[model samples]
Target: MVFPRPRPPERSDPASCGTHRACRSCWRDPGALPQGHGRIRRYAAGADLAAQGEPPADILTLIEGWLLLSALLSDGRRQILHIVVPGDVVVPLLVGSAGFGIQAATDATVCAMPVAAATTSPTAHPAGLHVLMKAMSRNAAMAYEHLTAVGRRTARERVALLLVELYYRCRRAAIPDHAVQIPLTQGVLADALGLTAVHVNRTLKTLRADGLVAYEGGMLRILDPDRLAAAACFDVEAAGAWLGPCPPGPPTPVPPTAPMPPGASR
Candidate 1:
């Protein structure tokens, strides 16, 4: 199912909107933009940014909110291939090849430009571009890790690994690691982990029992990150150095309560 690219950002007074370091790092080069660059747009809680099998267009960077990239099987089952957060970019082709990529989840705000323009922008510094490439590679590696999690880890271990991964990513984005925040649902987690929703539920309970994590109403708290990472066979340091010094940014803030994603209880 192909969906249209999101609308271009509206022209607005630059003076009215406050600037953040993270978004600046993404679109500007030390406080300046290349000529001909477009504006950054905002997306509501359930907007669709891209669809499967569409033409390769601009490179999209999620400045805010959570996004899921998914692929569907012939049987009509959807497999969430990736989860994107602020500062993450999605292109049809990560490095080599071409095809339409689809958005698998929701609550995403995206900024995109023609791929050619994006690559040539001076503000799109070489280092920033390199970081984006590395981000894509990391996402690929994560997919492999997910495969292993479902294929080898016990149900409990899978849940632990998922929570650990989420916490780690939230930390990198500067989101509060202990905050009660979970943007995905048990069913979505099941799809990504290749488990049934019921099994995902049971495994989550097991994680709480082991003091590894806690989940309620789609919110999760990592009780023992070390133990959880160990159970998932996750080495925090293995996350490569491609992120480029975590980009100058303010800590990610928890917004006032909003509607959780579909299938999410809390």
Candidate 2:
């Protein structure tokens, strides 16, 4: 199967958000946000939403587009630690998992809120706190698995795992027909996989040769998803936990002042 070229990132518009309701998971409990909390924000491609070493702020939920959370080595080399896609939280774990900053890989939008406001607002809802804790625990587990990929997997294995991960993420977002619409560059893939661009290109070529992945322009299609996942040593447990319950009223953005859980990592 050949994947079509991904369209350009969606332009953000603040007036476009319909209502200020909490996310489905949060709203489900009826006790999530205080009666009058939450805010939405839009970001352009290459925008830095959260920088490393900065004080904790509101948690960010990715309403659209791709995002990268990376950290700098002592030598200044950047390592792409995690990729945040639609429905994923940018800073869900806590304030001190690692020294990583979050940025948009493409045009994106998010709902951000202050950490303190989230926990302290007199209107804090118990149901909302329950959902938030569950989300953070889930994210923590994923970070551990991704760390394993970088530390123990071969370069090819790492790339395969990453693509499989992306495929699942897109699917959970209910993106049509299992399509991956992110404009992931070779250099970005290299950073995420902890390899050089040359190595990334070579591995992609190999996947193409095996007919496991089809690439055109910058888009990629997993022709034989089973084979691809197998090659990557994909973990069903990690993938399963990565996706939360479906959202209500489609995907939407939240306010930037959302609370920051102490355990939120990236």
Candidate 3:
């Protein structure tokens, strides 16, 4: 079921949209876009938002919950391309072809806008173009970084880095370290990191033993913030160096309340 949800953003002057930083700034800038049409829709956990090879016909911004961009192999194996959280834009593919499909990892709500607006905004609005460029560069850098991790990183390093990535993605200035939660299972981790489920289990066990992180059921708690990345030789600083400095951004803002679609579970 889909419902109309367009609650105006109460983003008090300084706030974090908490998705992709570049896009956050784009939304805040009044001149960033011209008036556009958009509507909100909701999906249940495990629902297919976009089918494989399907080109996105609209600009979809995740309003709540989690989404996974993944590809299914001939042998029935799946590799997760990336995870989508609130304030993040969802694109099946950024270039060439979209061999992937998007699924709601949890019950999710999305705001979809006209793709034509996105295609024209950059040219009609210079600020929009700048944001688009920044987003592209960030995407490229992350793609390279992910490729490097799968090719060169150890099992522990890969798992650790993946968790750290999620931690930062969902980071909230008000949420304490222990309170930060990522609702993902080991199978999801294994798919995202290119590892066997058994290997992912052992690696997580070792991480728990080291007192760096904890995983039980489908939830994860980061026990030690300072040591989690360092424990796996995952250098967040070095990775950022390639992309240039990121000025301190405001804390991520809570998303607008979107009413659930009828028949959706709580």
Judged by TM-score, which candidate is best?
2
Clash pairs (backbone) in predicted model 3: 16-252, 16-253
Q: How many backbone collisions does model 1 have?
A: 2
lDDT of 2 by residue, 1-266 (tens): 11122232234334322254425432454446544345667677887776676566667767767789888666667888788877776544455643677778887777665565556677666665665677677778778878899899998899888877776666566434334465677778888888988888788778878888764443465676568889998855546756543223223321111111122222
lDDT digits (tens) for residues 51-112 of candidate 1: 56655666666766777777665567877777776767676673543333445255555665
Task: State the TM-score for model 2.
Answer: 0.78
The parts of candidate 2 lying over 4 Å away from their true place are 1-22, 25-27, 92-98, 243-266
TM-score of each: 0.74, 0.78, 0.74
Superposed on all Cα atoms, the candidates' RMSDs to the truth, in angstroms, are: 5.3, 10.7, 9.0
lDDT score of residue 12 within candidate 2: 34
Residues forming the 10-long window of minimal summed lDDT in candidate 1: 9-18
lDDT at 14, model 1:
36
Error of 3 at 95 (Å): 5.9
> In model 1, which regions exceed 4 Å deviation?
1-21, 27-35, 94-101, 104-106, 120-128, 175-180, 215-218, 240-266
What lDDT is obtained when candidate 3 is compared to the true structure? Answer: 0.61
lDDT values, one for every candidate = 0.59, 0.64, 0.61
User: Which window of 10 residues has the lowest lDDT sum in candidate 2?
Assistant: 254-263
